[model samples]
Target: MFIRKLWAYLLGYLILVIKGEHPERLINLAYTRGVHLWDLCWIDAGTLTAKVYASSFRTLRHIAKKAGCRLRIRRKRGLPFLLFRLRRRRMLLVGAVVFCLILYCLSSFIWTVEVSGTRRISQQKVKELAAEAGLRPGSIRFQVQRDEVVDHLLRELPEIAYAEVNVGPRSRIRISEKQLPEPGVGYCHIVAEKEGVIESVLTLAGQPLVREGDVVRKGQVLISGEISPAPPGQDEQQGEQLPPRQEPRFVQARGIVHARVWYRFYGEAALEEIQERLTGRKTLIFRIKVPGKEVIVYGPREVPYQFCRLRTHRYKLQRWRNISLPVEFVTIEAEEVRHQHVRRSYEEAVEMAAERARERADRGLPREAVTVRRRYKVLGGDEDPVRVVLTVETRESIGVIRKFRPENQTDKTGGKEGV
Candidate 1:
């Protein structure tokens, strides 16, 4: 079929209007005579239009005469006629070729640069570094050293832990950078995250404020950032007769404070519940959307399903830079549905309720937590809705870093937020 179309296009074709009393006879005669014609359709009561090869169209004129039909060319198409028309506009042809050449040349050069993933480094600074490695806009794509550019960026920015340069189509350069971890706080302390008994305390650079077996409340400071030097030994003081004055020293203390924490959860499920179910009937609709309006291009104009659930998805056309058509395609699917009530037995309801309760009880439990104990209980009898309560106990580190106030910016409440 494609070969036939190509043959017609190369030899040229014509849309001829056959107007006469017996146009149908003209079509049959042409077919029997081995004259190719396509896209045949009735134009009106006495007129018919169809495509015929240019050479065969000439013979069609002869057939039209014998068949009592008058034939006239309505439109001319295909490469032969196109070239004939262009012959009269030589300058236009030259200009089109020149425009195409210019486009091809311009597309070969890089036009845009995009930098991403740099938090501390500015885009302009990064671009400058990239330019030194031959990655700036207007540079030849084949000439740019992608790996060298990445290595250069990493070399110039010590904080950058990961660097990559990706060259995209249309001469676009993208730089991805990942910076190092942020520096530690100048001053901070360890505080209890929840109300629990202190399991143990290990002070690395802070004053121990809580000890093992000591009960502590949420937000209580387990290790103080401030440290006071122990009083000089008595023997040293006696030998000197006078000891140097010692003042309490403040430090950015750090330590680990672990405490036991507990959580509780409750859940309820009915023995019978109503649920929406699909009826297996569905309709898919397509639409074209402009900036402010939309028109349905396919499917039923009016919604087909009365009791149905709808899901809509939209897709925007592929774009280049900031240039894009203000048009979008949307597809909507409506599935017919109905509501049904499902009844469950006591065992089924209990199992469902327990699962829900377990999810809640496990909420916020750390991976390192060791489950010391768990308890479950039904709060109500075999009612439609049965209530269940779940309690869990786990042993895990609860130490949370709580920053200490600077000496000059001390809060009036004496660090009340962290106790």
Candidate 2:
């Protein structure tokens, strides 16, 4: 504290000492007092500038009068560099302090949190869990470990099948939650809704139709719903009718089958975004706060944008976080965004659409299937968005079955042929 005060005082008034060419006679007269030497000059053929330290100006005058030399003393001037810096000292200091405050605030406050991919689990519940894990508004971002928080949430909530946490720039935290699997109503059969070549086959349940190296078309069965007779002749005798059974007879069965199947899919997406840049216009102000009191730093002023955003910055010791300094600064930034519709390249758009098609197919198909071959091509134009045709081949063979009863057969005949 003492050093700071001393520096402040010295800084207010700088010091410089200058001397001239003179020796013995000037030293002797120094003992006397009360003589003024505000204006004195010394003439030296070789050098004029010298160094000297005296307790009073009187002594300097005495020494000048005794010697045949001249002396002059006054505050130094003509230093425009020093003066300019001195004039802006307060501003520089305040700006530096405000910058540090902003950094501290960023480390302590949670700016953003995102929740995704949860249909069964409520977003509110996810937020609640995050808040409980120290991720609420104004929560300290520096003190929180995103991965650790996610793990904790997953452990605490059984409904969350998967969970993830992301920490972004400017103290933003994002949370991702996945819900647990619900009980299946019954065995869901994934048949060849559409068709393609069977590159591979994986049987999870029921009988398989086409094997690894087989080609199939639309409506072609990769897995059969019908059961083979115990033996070729073991089948019960029945009246043969004209036109063999065209409809597939469903038998009671449960299992999963994976066969490589290929189908076409399409997708379309728009690419456009807006950005902002300052046009050489900026303003700043300062504010102070007392106990339970508030006031504006500078007078109210209109900003550039219709929507204004205000950010508050504060300062406190790292170790003692509760004790905040009285000084505070708030910055308000107005941003204007212009909308633009950017269209992707024909090739790029086609590729994107094809990828989307493959993803959609995966969603529609059984999970047991694995993708093998994919082919995509553009078929249409811009404005309407280029048409992307995608053929994706995946391996999946799933089927459903139902048991046939004698009652069902009798009902088909209307009881006319029943005994």
Candidate 3:
């Protein structure tokens, strides 16, 4: 079927070339034969001219003989036959050349990675494993063992739970991590560290021996892990005034304690405060790998945005974090957000200042303390350096030291049992 189609196309090209070079005789023959010929065009390197069709190449030959025009025919070069009636066929010939050029251009670079999602696992390490698995840049995507490659990569890093390897115009490997087991050694009970009215309490690790509504003073135990005195035995006697024959052993328990602490904060913030503005903002992105050079995913360019003030927070690699390569980069994106008015009333401003002062007091005061009252005075005006005065009161238990030693603590072992 292919060969027949090839021959048919060649015959059409030959007939077209013959009629293109001679038109007068072909026209005359067509008039006499009372037969029709379809419209045909003659194309060459520099010209695209139309021609009157002819029934046969022989009829076209007879006309060309009278005109003294040379008849030249040749098989076209390149696959899919480039047959030409004339000696030259350069215009159509360039198609094959252009197709080859496009093929070359597409093969020169890596287009994209097919798989992603390597969080705890490194992308570069996966790529390296892919390279070892025979999947890398310039490698034909179809020839690689994708599943086998993924299995191999996972085997190299036991830390990876599951891996998926994909091969497309580019190759990519995605990895998931297995959760690490928690370290379970031992724990201590956290008691009411500084006693007060039990405004609120939480049991993070051990049991709670006190409730929110209960009242407890300094040095008062809130939670107890130590076992209560054993029930009196047959020979044992127990009473408020009676003493035991044997000494009791001392036990220790440890834990955390938090209370409903209160505080008062004071500051004056004006409605017409001056702040820096940004005209254009810039953001960037980059990637780096161990044993590999840092790569910029998107390169840098001139930022069109303006910035009046800027603040930044940063995170450093923790001791347990095992990042091998140090990849550092910064990004900026252009934005038009600018500083504008954020207005409030004088009473509102004083209220905000008073609330801030309260927060500060809460952080510094004992947890048992509860906010009770707040007092404030407008110290100044908006035009004249504005000032605000504030006072906060809270209810809480105060500490009282009942015993002291040479070290400020006397062991109570000498006290009579049950006394």
Candidate 4:
């Protein structure tokens, strides 16, 4: 159907309104004569409307005369008519072509340059370096060599480990910086950071001081850095004496100690409370700010609602490099709100209080902690505000490194070594 309509448009067509004794006779005669007519609509008992191709309209005129119907052209359409109109307004055609050319020319040049993944190195520095490599704004997109830009960035910045350049209308340059490894702390003991019952222990390079299911206190050593070697056995057959005991060795302790920890939180919710919310009715105020004065473009002088929320956003014209305009387009959105007193049931208040206690506990809990169980308790009389005590049990790693000097050690200053 679209192809047929496009064909009619390319060849030009006319909308004709036929009126007289019998307009249907004209349509039947045109159909029998193999002259196609589409979009036929009966206006009344003696009038009809239809569209016919410009080339076939002559044949329709003859058909109309034989059917005793007079035909009047309603509208002329298609590319031929458009060309004729443009032929008179030559400047409009020229302007349209020039606009298209401008868009095409602008698309070939880079307009904005952005730099990402930069931490130690400043974004401005990276952009300047990229500009030196011929990847700056206003440069031709096809002429900017990505490989050269990447090489330039890596060579100019010693901290940059990797670099990538994407060339387009808004060119983006991404870089990865080199990271130095942290120095290691030698000879340390792993101690319990919190008081809990040990659920499990994984000793990687340490002497185990406590086993699973053992109750430990805060600052207690869960894994010791001092390791003692086993004593030599006696030779009973030859009656030989036992060897001397070896001294204990102190090394860094490394391990994971998971323990079960408990937390208690208290919360309360009033049975009667006031709640304020937006009524979804809003008023907008637009203004222009220039230097020291502001002028309102539209909207009321004062807010309509007594109690409302105001959200203001300011926009300015696009700046070039370091130059910025003082004028700003400010839009203020005032949303009307109403406050009402709400009375919740005793059971509802209790549930709300419990949820609040649970949320508080969750916020205080560590991200790596896994919840194991929860218990809730209600306090106060039924008439009082719903007060709840929430007890949460969780399992988490409780081991932390505690540095200590070796026994009987001395520093360069002739002072005894300390933790």
Residue pairs with backbone atoms closer than 3 Å in model 4 (clashes): none
| Candidate 4 global TM-score | 0.49
Error of 4 at 208 (Å): 2.1
Candidate 3 global CA lDDT score:
0.50
Model 4: how large is the Cα RMSD against the reference?
A: 16.2
Question: Each model's TM-score, in the order given?
Answer: 0.46, 0.29, 0.28, 0.49
Off by over 4 Å in 4: 1-183, 228-246, 312-331, 407-419
lDDT measured at residue 252 in model 4 versus the true structure, 0 to 100: 71
Model 4, position 74: C-alpha lDDT score:
95
Residue pairs that clash (backbone atoms under 3 angstroms), model 1: none
List residue ranges in candidate 3 displaced over 4 A. 1-263, 276-284, 287-295, 308-337, 341-367, 380-384, 400-403, 406-419
Mind giving the per-residue lDDT tens digits that candidate 4 earns over 75-115?
A: 99899989999999999999999999999899999999999
Candidate 2 residue lDDT tens string, 1-419: 67744443444322223343553345445434443222223334422433233335446655576676555543432344355665779788678789999987676677777677667567777777777877766666777788777877766664443465765433333333321112332222335544555544444443676776566555555554353333223324675443434333433234433345656677764443243444444444334555687566774555545433344455433445777555544554444444444657656766666777767776775554556777777665664455666777665443333223422445432222211
Shift of residue 128 alpha carbon in model 4, Å: 52
Please, what is the whole-model Cα lDDT of each candidate in the order they appear? 0.76, 0.51, 0.50, 0.86
Per-prediction tally of clashes? 0, 18, 34, 0
Full-model lDDT, candidate 2: 0.51
As for TM-score, the candidate ahead, 1 or 3, is 1
lDDT of 4: 0.86
